[model samples]
Target: MSRSPSFSRPPPKQFNTRRPQPVAEVLKRTDAFAALRAGVEQIAALEKDLRQLLPDYLGSGVEPGFIKDGVLALFAAHNALAARLRHLEPRLLSDLQQRGWAVNALRIRVRPQAVKEPPPVKQARMTPVGADALHALSESLAPSPLQAALARMAARHLRNREPKK
Candidate 1:
């Protein structure tokens, strides 16, 4: 006699009735959060103004920094760019004022842009002359760890150019 396998009933499905809350309502509900959001918005507006003033020059290296005690800060990717920004402080102040911003002092700070290091390049066969020079230099040196290592490396490079038997 053969027996058949039976399957069990699946669990019941659940439905969520709650809807997402609106951002405006949430901001309105919290005073500190609302103020923080407003400050962020102001910084964004300042960044927009900067882009309008100097388009394509900033790229992703420059950004609007926070304003504290009426001092506005701008971040630049490199010192050169920071210097340029400093030079434009007067213009920046005037432009900010025109755009309805209460400007007191403009500060430019250098913040190096983060970049991924490039992949290491594979070792290529050294030229005969270069290999010969390295070999000679290695031989001229007194026998020691560095000399041995250099000689070994030079031999490897020279051997790399030779056809394997």
Candidate 2:
């Protein structure tokens, strides 16, 4: 009974029986996409080299953004990591230069990981019984700020529950 009725029917004419080409093969066929893929590969290679030159902690926290006009852009996970990277800029620049990289300056930017906030809490409504209980409790208490607050809360709850004309 759970089987789809369409299972007995033939597929529509729009369906293609041929297998699709691999993504890399498809991208390589387009000139623009091929260039973009090449740039991405170059950046990845640069990042790997930079990572090898850095300490474990710094390497893990940093990612190479891009290199343009002799300026290499780097993204750090936090301000502390960025600060550390900035301090090591001179040494890194020299090292990269010595390794035949045409880098002249390092541009470090903070790029923190996005944090997901918890869903908002749903407010609990006071039942008539609960409001009545609060009213009774307020009545029993002597004149005080707490008693007044409880009385106001009870009245508000009961008033809100009343139907309008």
**Highest TM-score: which candidate?**
2
Candidate 1 steric clashes: 0
TM-score of 2: 0.53
56-160 in candidate 2: lDDT tens per residue?
A: 999988888777998999999999999999999999989888888888899999999777699999676899999999999999999999999999999999998
Badly placed stretches (over 4 Å) of model 2 are 1-26, 116-165
TM-score of each: 0.52, 0.53
TM-score of predicted model 1? 0.52
**Residue pairs whose backbone atoms clash in candidate 2:** none
lDDT of 1 by residue, 120-151 (tens): 99867788899999999999999999899989
